[model samples]
Target: MDRQTRSLLAHADHPIAAPLDDDSVGRLLTRAVVRDDARVLDLGCGSAAWLIRALGQRPGVTAAGVDVSAEALERARRAAEEAGVDGRLTLHRGEAAAFEAPHPFEAVLSVGATHAFGGLLPTLDAALRHLAPGGTVLVGDAYWEREPSRWARETLGEYEDLAGTVEKVTAEGWTPVYAHLSTRHELDDYEWNWTGSLSRWALDHPEHPDSAEALRAAARHRDEWLHGYRESFGFVCMALRRTTDT
Candidate 1:
């Protein structure tokens, strides 16, 4: 993640930074191909909710999470302690692409944080580097729901259609296994959650210097989402497996 992303999220009080609905996380885990004591790495893992839940479920699994935000990492550490998995959960504060573990991970999940690697293909390439043989790679990202107007394209930047994304993943030597997509209703909820949470945070922290920035960010999210990009974009969680030895 970039400094701007960390800066924006630093002032916000949301547990999760992105609109990835909580329910979609379970679907991502189900899609992952796990083995006994699977080692997992969560790139740009905010608050470590996914990591804690995964460790709780597998019990035998150990996980690591990387995020550049100190505030987010603090929350993640607290969550791990509360979940009694802190002993097995390692949290690092740095660029996601710079994260290195003692060995390759059996499952690597980067949901809604591909920008950490700059783009889709770059993200996949970095993730593949850390994957064990037959490991799972899960990425949750937004795509064009329809051909956007030029204005919208300029605002949203480059994003592949669902079919194009799948094709590219397959071409990269990953076997597409399963996918979960966010519905229009879920997307609405996700966007609204950010606005609502950030607004309330700004209200409660009026004395904070960054409160105004938080409020402005909330407004920007709402404006861009409702007016500029609404109905034109969709989010998907695609899970793939390494087809060949890494």
Candidate 2:
């Protein structure tokens, strides 16, 4: 959500710590309470990061990744095969905005893609649709500036609508498990580390012209977030644990 995070995710697998660190991600997987034989659905799963990580670290769980990008899906597939987790990790190319559950997943996760789906409304809708009762959904996105003077919308662009999105989720059946508002330094580390790896990988994959360009373009598109938010940028990630009690 911050400039640094945007940069890092743009360069996922960088030598440094991305805005979203591997340790934090691993901790998310560990805390998810995924039961034996539980099925996990990863929305916008680029390179199957969470899926592959879960398979390697946590056995007896099925991990499935869905994304709109065919190239991203292929990379995810390759990663699974290489990890020898292909049997348990299923990668699919599908629309993230209105993706349907192939089956009810025990856990649903969407990383930076939550912001891409027009803030929280569509994201929560998709996650709720796929989750079984008592399922979990992990989401990470940008937050507001610290103790803002003007409205977030006036200063921030698309992210201005995030607050309302958070409200809608609470009104829905999903209960917020964690809303981590990370500091600037944390976000900076994440973006740098994440995107650094991505840049290298993109350079290596000369076949993907668009992806390479996108990697380069990350700075241009996200320059504002990094600059403006750095003065007071924030990171927010919430894991919604769905319950029939809703």
lDDT top scorer: 1
- List the global CA lDDT of all models: 0.79, 0.67
* TM-score for candidate 1: 0.91
lDDT of 1 at 142: 76
**Weakest ten-residue segment in model 1 by summed lDDT:** 5-14
The sequence of per-residue lDDT tens digits that candidate 1 reaches over residues 1-246 is 344453445335435454565677766786683665899999989787778878887889999999887877887888799889999999999999988777899999888888889887888888888888878988878788888767778877788888987888889888878888788877787677768877877788899887788888789878988888887888888888877866
- How high is the lDDT of residue 39 in model 2? 90
Best TM-score among the predictions, by candidate number: 1
Query: What is the alpha-carbon lDDT for the whole of candidate 2?
Result: 0.67
Model 2 lDDT, residue 191, Cα: 56
Residues 142-208 of candidate 2: C-alpha lDDT, one tens digit per residue: 6555444353446654453347557767777667776555556668776555445556555676686
